[model samples]
Target: MANSLVSIQILPKTKNGENVIPYVDEAINVIHQSGLTYQVNPLETTIEGELGQIFSIITEMNERMIEMGSSNVISQIKVLYQPSGITMAELTEKYR
Candidate 1:
C-alpha cells in the first residue's frame, strides 16, 4: 500500500533558453509510466506510492531531463509520509 505522497515541480534548464513545457511533459510521462496514483496540478504533480518507489521515480524523472538535453535540472519537492498508510483520495476527500 502507498504510504507517502510526494509532489514535485521539475525545472529543466533547456538549451538555448528554449521553452520547457515539453520537458515538463517528459517528466510527467515518467510518473505516468510508474502506474502509481498521481495528480497533475498547475504548479506541481503529486504522486502516491511507497517512499522508496517514489524516490526512484523522482530520480528517473531528473535523469530523463538530462537525457533530453537539459544542461541542468532543478526539482522542488514536498513529501508527506504516514507509516500506517495514506492515499491521495484520503487527503483530498473532504475537498472533493
Candidate 2:
C-alpha cells in the first residue's frame, strides 16, 4: 500500500492573483470526492492518500491554474511515505 503525503505551493504573477484559489479549491474537491482527507493553507496545501491520487490531484490543480491564466505559476510539491505515520526520522532517511 502506498500511503503518501504531498505539500504544494503555487505562486502566480498576474492581476488575477486570487484566481489560483479556485484551482486549489478544485483540487481539494477532487480529494474530498475521492474520500480522502487533506489540509489546506493559503497558497499551500497538504494531502494524504495513495501516491497516484496525490499526484493526480496535483496534476489537475496545475492544469486548472494554467487554464485560469496564471502566468509563470510554479508548484513546489513534497512527497512523503508514511510507513508508521510521519516522523522526522523518515524525512531524514529520504532526504539525507
Candidate 3:
C-alpha cells in the first residue's frame, strides 16, 4: 500500500504576462510522467507515492517552471504520511 498522499497546486508567473494554462499543463506533466498513481482535480493534483518521491516531484515541477521562463512559482501543498501505510482509496472511499 502507498504510504503517502501529496496534493499540489502550482502557480507559475509567466514572462510577459502570458497565459499560464500551458505552464500549468507542463507542471502536471511532471507528475504524469512520474509513474505514480494520481488524480487531477480542478484546483490541484493529488499523487500517491513514497514521501521522498512526492517531494522530489514538487521540486522538479518548480524547476521546470523556471526553465519555462517563469519569474517565480508558488506551490501550495498538502501531505499525509503513514509509517504503517495508508492509501487514497482507504481514506476517501467512505465518501465515494
TM-score of each: 0.98, 0.63, 0.95
> In model 3, which range of ten residues has the least summed lDDT?
82-91
- lDDT against the true structure, per candidate, is 0.97, 0.67, 0.94
Residues 1-90, candidate 1: write the lDDT tens digits.
Answer: 789999999999999999999999999999999999999999999999999999999999999999999989999999999989999999
- In candidate 2, how many Å is residue 54 off? 0.6
TM-score, cand. 3: 0.95
Off by over 4 Å in 1: none
What are the C-alpha RMSDs, in order, of all predicted structures? 0.5, 5.6, 0.8
Show where candidate 2 strays beyond 4 Å: 15-34, 83-96
Better of 1 and 3 by lDDT: 1
Error of 1 at 21 (Å): 0.5
Candidate achieving the largest TM-score: 1
Q: Which residue pairs in model 1 clash with each other? A: none
Q: Look at candidate 3 and tell me the lDDT of residue 18.
A: 98
- lDDT: which candidate is best? 1
Give the alpha carbon lDDT tens digit for every residue of 17-91 in model 3.
999999999999999999999999999999999999899999999999999999899999999998778778988
Give the distance in Å from residue 32's predicted Cα in candidate 3 to where it truly belongs.
0.8
Off by over 4 Å in 3: none
